[model samples]
Target: MPIPKVQKLFQKTFFGIFSMFGVIGFSTSVLCVYTVDTHLSAEYESNSRDIAKTIADSSVDILLNRDLATLQSLIDQFVEIQGISYIYITDETGTFLAHTFVPGLPEVIRQSDPSNTDTVERNLPGMGDFVEVGSPILAGVGGAVHVGMDTGLVALKIQRAIGQQIYLFSTVFIIGVFAAVWFVNLAAKPLGELLGYAVALAKDGAKAPPSDSLLRRNDEAGQLARLLLHCAGFTDADNKRGVAAPGEAR
Candidate 1:
C-alpha cells in the first residue's frame, strides 16, 4: 500500500530517535554495569583478604608446631566459610603440603615467579573461575596460605543488575518518544490547517482565507504564511494585467 509523505516522515523521525536513544542507552548501561562490577569486585576482594589473613594467622602457629591434627581442623574451618572454593597451604618450594579439596598431596601447585609481586593477582589456568589470593603466613617464613573464592556469584549479580537497568531505560525511552510525537503534533496543528488553506487557493484560485492566529506570530511558519499571501497577490496582479505584444496587431 502507498503511504503518505507525512506518515513516512514521522516514521523515519521516530526510528531515528529510537536508534539514537538505543545507542546512548546501551553505552551508558554498559559503563554503569562495569562500574558496579568493579566496585563489587573490590569490596569482595578486600573482605576476602581480611578473612584469608585471619585464617593464615590462626593456622600458621599450629603448622609451625607440627600439630597435624590441629592444622587439619583449621583447614576444615577455613573451607567452611561461604563462597570459599578451595584452600591450600604451601611451602616455599611450591609443594602443596595440605589442601581442602584434594587430600594427601596435590601433584601441582599453581605459582608464578613474576618479577613484580602484583603478578599474583593475575588470573591463572587450573585455578577454576575464582579469585585466588595468597599471603605469607609468617615474616621470613617459607610458608604461604592460598585461598580461592568463587566469583561466579558476583558475575551473576552484575548481570541481573544490567538486565534490570535495560528494562527500566527502555520503558523510559519509549515513553519519551511518545511524548515528543504528541508535542510535535500539537504544535504543528495550526500549520497543518494553514497549509490546507494555501493548497485550496492554489488549486481553485479562490479568495485567500483570513490570516488567523498563525499569521499573528513572528515565527518561521508565520513568516511562510505571509510570503504565500504576498505571492498570491502578485499572481492575481499578473492575471489582471494581461500584457499583449505589439506585433499581434492589437
Candidate 2:
C-alpha cells in the first residue's frame, strides 16, 4: 500500500509552537485564578472573623450590664465596614438580641453552633451568599457576635482579577502566535528546499545542482544542504557556477 501522506515540517513546527503556547497560557490562567481565589477568600474570611471577635470582645462588658441599645449601636457602626453584609448578636439561649437583617433573622444563623469557632459559607434566601464567622461572647458566657461577609463581593473581586490575568495571557498568546509563524516560516524554507531536493533525487537522478545560496548558508540548514549536495555527487565547480543570494558568500 502507498504510504499515507504526512504533514510537512512547516505545518508540524507551526502546530507544535501553537500547542505549546496554548497549553502554557491555559495553565497559567488556571493557576492565577486559583491563587487569586484562595488568597482573597482567606483574607476576607480572616477579616470577618477578626471583626466578629472585636465586636464580641467589646460587647462583653456592655452585654453584662444588659445594655442592648449600646450593643445594637456598636454593631450598627461595624456593619458599615466593607464586605460585612450583616451583623447580629445572640444570647446564650440562642435568642437574637440584635440583628441587622431588615425583615427577620435567617434560619441558617440560628442553626449555627455559637460554641464552634469556624468560618462557614451559607446562602440565605433573598439575601444572596455569605461567609458566616461567629465569635463567642465572653467565651460563650455573654452572647456571641456573628458577622456575615458578602461572598458576592469576594467573588466579584476574584472574577475581576482573573479577567485581568486572562486578558494579559491572551495578549501574550496572540503575540506569540505571530512570532511562532515567523520562526516556523524562517526555519521551514531551507527544510522545504532540502526535502524537494531529496525527493527529486529519489524519483530521478538529480540533474539540477543545489543553488550557491544553499551552499553559502551559515546555519545548520546550510550544513544539511551542503551534505545533501556532496552526497548527490555535485562537485565544487558545479555550485561555483551558480550565484549566491544577496549578502552571502559562496
Candidate 3:
C-alpha cells in the first residue's frame, strides 16, 4: 500500500495556532474592557450616592429653615469633585429648593420621579448624560438631595483603560503569530526537503544518501533519516559502491 501524502500540514499548524491565540486574545481583551467599564461606572455611581446622602444629612436643618444661601454654598464645594455634574436639593413634597443649574433644570430631570430615592440616569441639556443619584433629606422627612455624576467623563476614562488593554493584547497576539510561523516552518522545511528522498527510496529502489542537512538534523526527522540510511545502506560508503542516485530531483 502506498503512503498517503500529507497535504497542507504547515498551513494547518499555522492556522491552528493563529485561531487559538486569536480567540483567546479577543475574549480576554473583551473581558478586561468589560471589567474596567463596570468597575468605573459602579464606583462613580457609588460616589454619587454617598455624596447625595451626605448632602441630605447636612441640609436637614438648613432646608427646614429654607436657608438657600448656605445650602448653595454647601453644594458648591462638591461640584469641584471630578464626575460631579450638578447637585440639587428638594423638599419632601418633591419641590426643588436649591440647585446649581444656572439656566434652569432640564425637563428630563423634572420628569424624573424624585420620590424614588435611588440612583438613576439622566441627560441634561448641553451637559451630556449623567448617573443621577438621589438621597432623602432627613430620611425622606426633610426632603431629597439629587446628585448628577458625569458619565461622559467616566466613558472617556473607560476608553483610555480599554485602549491600553487592546494595545497590550495586540502586541502579544502579533508576537504569538510570528512564533507560530517560525515553529511550523522549522518542522515543515525538513519534511519538504525529504519529499524527493522518500519518493526515490520508496519507489525506485535507489540508495543515494539523503542531504547532509537532513541527516544532520537533531529532531525526529533526523533520527528517521539516519535509520533509513542504516536499513538501506544509503551511506557515503554505499554511494561509492557504483549504485547511481535515482533520477528523481532532491
Query: Global lDDT of each model?
Result: 0.63, 0.78, 0.77
Better of 2 and 3 by TM-score: 3
Superposed by TM-score, candidate 1 places the C-alpha of residue 86 at a distance from the truth, in angstroms, of: 2.0
* 52 Cα displacement, candidate 3 (Å): 0.6
Candidate 1, residues 1-250, lDDT tens digits: the string is 1111234546677788888998988898889789988998877777667766776688777877878677767778877777676667766565556678654333333444211112133343454477767666664274677776778767887888888888898899979988978976865665665666577667775374425565554565566655565555545443234312112211
TM-score of 2: 0.77
Candidate 1, residue 200: Cα displacement in angstroms equals: 1.6
Task: List the lowest-lDDT window of 10 residues for candidate 3.
Answer: 241-250
Best by lDDT: 2
Q: What does candidate 3's lDDT look like per residue over 81-200, in tens digits?
A: 998989988787888888888689888878777777776777777879988888887778887898998889988987888788778878988888888777767677767656666777
Candidate order, lDDT descending: 2, 3, 1
Off by over 4 Å in 2: 1-7, 64-66, 110-117, 196-208, 227-250
Q: lDDT value for candidate 1?
A: 0.63
Using lDDT as the yardstick, the better of models 2 and 3 is 2
Per-candidate TM equals 0.66, 0.77, 0.80
lDDT of 2: 0.78
Question: Could you tell me the TM-score of candidate 1?
Answer: 0.66
The residue ranges of model 3 lying beyond 4 angstroms of the native Cα positions read 1-7, 200-207, 230-232, 235-250
If candidate 1 were superposed on the true structure by all CA atoms, what would the RMSD be? 9.2
